[model samples]
Target: MVLEENKTSSKAPVGEFNSSDLEVGGVVVYRDRAEVKRMIRVSVKKGENDVVVNQLPSVVDPKSLRVEGEGDAIITDVIYQSKTNYDEKTKGDKKQYDKLQDEIKELVEKEKFLTFKLEVITKQRTILNKFAEQICKFSDSSKEEKADMSEILKSGSVDGVMGFLTAYQDKMSHLDEQWRMHDREKTTLTEQLNVLRKNAQDLNPTTVKDAKTNRCVCISLEAASDTDVVLALSYVVSNASWTPQYDLRVFSNDKTMKVFYYGLIKQSTGEDWLDAKLSLSTANPSIGGSVPELGVQLLKFKQPVVVSKSKRTSHRINYDELMLCSSAIGGGLQEYDPTIEDSCLEELEQKSTGKAIAPIEITTTQVETNWTSVAFNIPRMATIPSDNTEHKVTVTSVGLKPEFEYAIIPRMSSHTYLQAVVKNTSSYALLSGPANVFLDNNFVAKSSLKDVSPSEEFHCSLGVDPSIRLTTIPVKVLRGQSGLISKSVTVDYRHMFEVKNTKQEQVKVTLSEQLPLSTDERIKVHLNDPDVRKVNTPVNLPFGTVTLNSSNNLDWVVNIPTNTTQPITLTYSVEYPPGHVVQGLPKN
Candidate 1:
């Protein structure tokens, strides 16, 4: 933001105040209002003096202004007001709107000329094409009407009609080239004209209006005998904000992943911040500051009402009662599971039962108050312009030991996705923000972060990997079953998954599969799990019931060794009364 200074005197000046050096100390950025802090050094004589600090954004709320005086100087009053001048420009910048309007007029005339030329070229090209098409019919038309081409050829004497036809062909080719040139010129002229029109859009009738110069903060001070004082001022202003971003990089040889945290700062606050120490906070200054007071409660009696006659269904699906786990598709199916879902994650106090992985360590200089919010203090000062452009600054970097896995849902997608799972082990909380994922120095995909606490684990997608392949096919199918007393019908489907790892290195994969859910007690569904312990060395095991969050789907974490192929099977059966039929089955 641009800044200017103004000083004024009233009556006989009893003291002279000097203030030249003003430094921006810190800035606490909120969602809407930012708390700006500035420190200025002052020296004054032994009597009353007038001091004014000018050049601030007009959006600053006067009620939120604050001032502090050090040393023996006692501040009598602080006032906020606007400052405007009669003329702010010389003759060169006097009629700014008139200048833009003149430029627009010149460009518009150029555009008209280009358009006319393009139309002429288009007409010429159309006529040439028509003549070329009729050239083939000249032999037939000449025999019925005038001199034929054969007669002209027999009596080739002086007229040179052959030269005329050749010249016409040459002219048509030249026009074809000229037509393309005119079209490009027209496109360029149109673009230039549009830019000029946009520039002159705000100037109606070619007149410029005077704008407010700036805002000022005036202070009346009294210093006791040549005292030096330090004054601090802070206020809230709009049009300034910052958002968090992350860059996560994983290496081929290293087990730990590196996370580079950043914040994108932007402002159109009418003034630029130059060489200022920036602090990003997750606080909103507009959320009211006053403490709440308790009030007395009173109760009243009323007549009872009647109930409606609508009974509930017995086969209703209570989605709320079904506490789904955290890994519910990872795409907005956020049914919160009261119980822990990952068999690798036991109780908070107990270690995981699966194969042990390394721990992640975070490093940063940040101040966190709650699990949902944190503030970052930038180590170095920066200069951000007031042009509403993004400027990214590194907040901190942390090293995370993430477990890599390939997750897939064969029914929904044929390709398997690589996922990196890790916990936020930093002392500070990680806010929700956009993240860029990278692997082995190559950019993978864009992801996002959510509210994660110190030890809360979150999933980050590493995009699709082509080395590992999977195929699913129906291996067994059975239909029609009957009994005498308890007559029933049954159908069984056995799905087989064939997987292969073509890469030279071993890969860890997690496959997510779903089973059909039965809402009625009479309808039953069953699953048969095949043992997959022979797949890997320390054999990936199913620690707990993977079908807790869902009645049908199961999750399997597998480690595929290099140049290895394996097959896994899961069977599900549906049974119902003999006379009943299912509605949503495949046509085949």
Candidate 2:
């Protein structure tokens, strides 16, 4: 697409070397790279006019550079190169570097002078301390010696001993004040030297190798007529990137939630994007755009190979590495895999530089969805500095109606967990990311959200809910032998669970329990208490409805009344031939 041009009041005179005033007009940040668009308006002559655009980031990919313009101008050719100013010592950055060095040298000299003055004051103070000690010793001497000292002082002083002491006090006070002033000066000089030295280092020769070595674009365009042409230049840079984040605010009373979507951007591209139009995309250009092709598969007979035990090795895939490969193959971020070890994941997260941002209310932005990706246009102009810090911007937020229910697995834990099922109603697609869940203005838990499309539903688990209490009664196992003639064996099992709701309003709970499934051909299993065989067939009880799923798990959906308790009982038995053992049975 052709870039949109902005108008400018300044123009270049004809037949003159003109440097274009390029400003960053827009930036579209992707998963691992960013596309920067610059705009300028310049007047051109009838023939070919050479326009030079300098101060481009060094990380800009020259291959991806493109120039588009409007007005009566035919673009000829563009030359991209790194403009090095290493030899021009009297111009631009070299002069600045020299100035910084001079300032630093001057400050260092002043610092040395202050240090000398402070040393002199310290010596004077030390002499004054010695004189005071001598006078104290004279005052503690015998009366005859004291009298002799007084006579000597009176003979030498024009005033008296008191006047002599006053003079000494005045001199000491003056020295102390001078020392304080010199110390303050020294501190100020040290601070100035630090600042100047830092500035000089930034402008040093290596800076010329890095920062001053800028990418420049020279465009030679032919104008059909003398007119002002608006040019838009775009290029891709690899140093800027963004990742998706989310905030889920749940309202339990209304059964609704608001999902705030954000993009965390980090860029160190050596150029500040000030008040530029910003957009976030889910595309990762680093993995390339070519579709992968598969070769024909050939079948061969299996062969066995033997190896020494000492020479054999085992290689296991790491969770983070596997996830990284999966994300690369998926074209975007992949869903969170719970199979990853929590300790490993937590350690990796702790080591990451990206920090969690506090939640805030935000307005939704405009979204554009395509067949393969989606882009969000920020509503206002964004300013991102060259410092590599996470700058989070609100992409969009949507209010979703959620279905809330409590899930209880008494076999694993007695605590009941609240879960919410939400459907994406907005036009923007949701990428996989970490989400912070807040319940009625209080933070409850942190959950991971999977990639979801518009009109798709996903579930989020809010941590344990203490309002509903659950108790699992101990299971009773009755082992006996039946059919004496055939010598058969039968084992009976019984389980009971108690659920109590303490809330003022009724709550829905899903209680799940596991039952043993026989793998042996001679073993027979039967449900004696609550007979059920078909799936989705509800067995209605006084408190709830029970359903036996294909996984040999019994799920009960119960609506417990306020301040009431409900009890659920499950009974089953296993029949096997004599001298045969049964596994997976409860120990107690």
Candidate 3:
């Protein structure tokens, strides 16, 4: 019995079936070439009975089958238990799939509803467009009507249109208004979004980091020593996030108090850059206003200053020695150095400490003394005794200290007198007695003195002969045993002497003379033809030897020969016994 396997068109061999063609509950089989050929032939022979043929078993008796002609075949049963199981699973899957299909259909219906709503909205938009066109047409038709309509709309009035049209128009207007408001809201929201975006973009991390990475430092001058100066550095971070560290140093070229400040600052943010500033000030005191204008300029500082070295020199003067010499020259002496004291020396020391020092040696030089004299003439008529007689006169020096001399002379003025100060080196005062004074070999006057002190002074008036040829008055002083003594010393004192010559012609005469005379002896002379010559004779001649009984006149006579210009001389002697005590002249 050769049972043929039938193949259905839709259910042919399941060889390498794709998922699109394969179905659940189907069976597949692997077959050799001969079996496949045989199956195909059998399906062709019983096309209409393929189903029945497939149900029959395909058999060529295995024992009679040639191994060469037979090949192994893998059969897939389309209706076996596996097929049943696969069919049952497929049926269950179909039910679940149908449920899912129903859900998809519901979602499709909802999408159709939303599409219909979109279509309605489109139709409404068209209607609104038509209404807007009508409104534009009306507005264009008449300006007055358009203005009225615009005013009514602006006033929120909707009474102009008919009922349903009004309602639809109102709905449409409401929708339009809502759309416009929404658009405005959207525009505002968009603008805000743009601003936020811009702000976000502008936030640059690099720039912020750089700002936080830098700092500045400043150094200020504090103080200085001989070799180095101290400075204080203040570090300031521009950004608060940064703190800086600095390495500070001072540099200078000067050996004393010279310095410069330098430093580097690093940001605490670990940055690589720094900045700094430096300021300097001096420690010296400004000059005071007490100095003179020029002196202040001299003391002005032109550059930076360091320590100052004193350059002062000491100067000294001996007030005591100067006083002594000055007193000896008739200078008035007063107490000196009473104002200088220890306090003054201390002040001087303090002042000199900072000043330039200099060595000073002082030596004293004396001031010289000067003396001057002026004279006036005394007239012959002004003589003390009116009678013209030759007498020995004396004049005592006056008005000056001891050791000084003076001379009495006739002045040029009539009846005037002249006196002269004489230089003296002696330490004693001068004294004399009354004797005859002469001028031009003629008698002039007489002089005398009493007691006078060294510091005391006096004034005298002497006579001159108008007829005598005399330029000065000649006075005589008798040297006494008692001499003058000087009492005091002085510095630079002055004595004034005055002389007067009465005669018109210049008269020449011996100014002073010394004579020896007695205290009471009187000598007289016989004047032969005395009327031809004027005689200024002394009242008493203290030296002579003659008979007193002979009219108190002397036998000695001075003869005046006619027309002769010879001067006469007479000699007389006086004696004072020895062993007489004499007092020294008074100081003046």
Index of the highest-lDDT prediction? 2
The RMSD (Cα, Å) of candidate 2 is: 23.9
Error of 2 at 255 (Å): 3.9
Worst 10 residues of 2 by lDDT: 340-349
Model 2, span 1-588: residue lDDT tens = 222222121334242221223577789999898999888788887877777677677687878888898889987766766645566553566678888988887777777777776765665566545445545777567776667656645553435335435566776777788889989888888888888888777777765554456556667778887899888888898889998777787876667788877788989988888888999998877788898999999999889797657311122223343333223222242222122111111111122567854444455588877777888999878889889888878787778998888999988888999999888887878999988777875678878899999999999998898999998888999988888488778899999989999999898999998877889878888898677778778888777788988888999999998999999888998889988667778767
Instruction: Give the per-residue lDDT of model 3 (tens digit) for 35-136.
Output: 101112111211111111111112211222111111122122222100112245445554555555555555445445444444443445554454445555
Off by over 4 Å in 2: 1-21, 82-213, 286-291, 294-363, 481-489, 517-544, 547-552, 574-583
Q: How many backbone clashes does candidate 3 have?
A: 76
- The TM-scores of all predictions, comma-separated, are 0.59, 0.62, 0.16
Separately for all candidates shown, the number of backbone clashes (residues 3 or more apart, or on different chains) is 6, 0, 76
Winner by TM-score: 2
Off by over 4 Å in 3: 1-90, 142-161, 164-169, 173-588
lDDT against the true structure, each candidate: 0.64, 0.75, 0.26
Which pairs clash in the backbone of model 2?
Answer: none
If both were scored by lDDT, which would come out higher, candidate 2 or candidate 3?
2
lDDT of 1 at 172: 63
